[model samples]
Target: MPEKTIPILPCRTLQPVLDFYTALGFEVTYQQRSPNPYAVVERGGIELQFFAMKQYEPAVSISTCYVLTDDVDGLYQAFRAGLKETYGRIPTRGLPRVGPLKDMTYGVRQFLVTDPGGNCVRVGQRTGGERHHGPAPQETFARALHFASLLADSKGDPAGAAKVVDRALALTDETPTRVQLLQLLVLRADAAARLGDEEAAVTGLARAAALHLTAAERDQGRDALTRLADLRGSLRP
Candidate 1:
């Protein structure tokens, strides 16, 4: 017989935890309500066990897990679609939002998704060296976007951010998803504006505006519109 270890995680309530996993394509294998709550969820060959704790505070909890997979981007897309389907819109900054896929310094391409119970499940694919070749082109672009974000927001280097995005843009062509193209353009515009390059900012905004957007994309661009307006105001003579 082989020994398999399944994590037993604590949750404030079992139902939300169940719902979260269910949305991510997991099925409830067993559940109990009376005499202390507990449940088991399984997806593919992975299994998770969750227990209810009335005093559990997810905000202070330090529960985390790593889900290694060969198709990290595909699973991430599925999870993103599931989250949006369940929550109407994916959360931008909180538990339940999926983080962008990144190539860690430790040499793995990974993304993080925090469950309702505040459990961080990192989906990763081993890369770098003969053990694995490299991530797909889309994954590389995703990693670049993540780096550009840190440069723009954390390091406060908009020029560096613009350069990172420019490198990604060079790698991409018309085959890239409209969402990716739009996001890259928006980020570039933001970086240009922060660099005091009004012409470049205006040009990037115009390019983004020319793209045919879906209803959801239009709604998502509202924030971009506000930023564009502010940039235009600053450029007025």
Candidate 2:
């Protein structure tokens, strides 16, 4: 027989916590509210237990667990689609979102998804003998945006995401194309809002809104605007 370990996490509310994981394809196996508040959820053989803590603050708490998967990419894609379908948009600035996959130096491909309670579920798979050829500058910037999305949306660390996007923007060429600039500004606005910096968020959004978009850039701009609106709406009042 094999031994299995399940993570016990704390959440401000048990029902919403259960709902979040359920939306991520987990099944609620057990739930109780009268006996000090507890619940259990399972998906693909992974089980997690959560307890309710009335004073738990997701922004300040540091709790995480790892879920090793045999198909990291597939699982990420499924979660991404599920999130988009449920939320109208993949929340990249306040709520849970699937992160970009990366081949870690530790010899595994991995990504992450944080529950609404700020419990990080690191999903990883062994990448035996696989080498990562560094990406080009544009590709690097794209990866940075993906990482920022994960930090802001999944980990509830918009401040951290802002730092990553800032470096990405700095490394960008001085005379970047309109599309490139638009993307960077949009991401900046998202991170700012998540960090509760309304002025910065407005400034970034204004800059992005003023950009002159080409026909192709118009399509991307529309999507970015929707994301920006969602991010702004989620900001603490």
Off by over 4 Å in 1: 129-237
RMSD of each: 10.2, 5.8
lDDT of 2: 0.72
Show the colliding residue pairs in model 2: none
TM-scores for all predictions: 0.57, 0.63
lDDT of 1 at 69: 86
Q: Local error of candidate 1 at 74, Å?
A: 1.3
Task: Give model 2's TM-score versus the native structure.
Answer: 0.63
lDDT of each residue in 120-225, candidate 2, tens digit only: 7889898776545333236666667667655764556778888987887787454456766676687778767656687998888778878878888877555465
For candidate 1, what is the lDDT? 0.71
Model 1: residue 230 alpha-carbon error in angstroms: 22
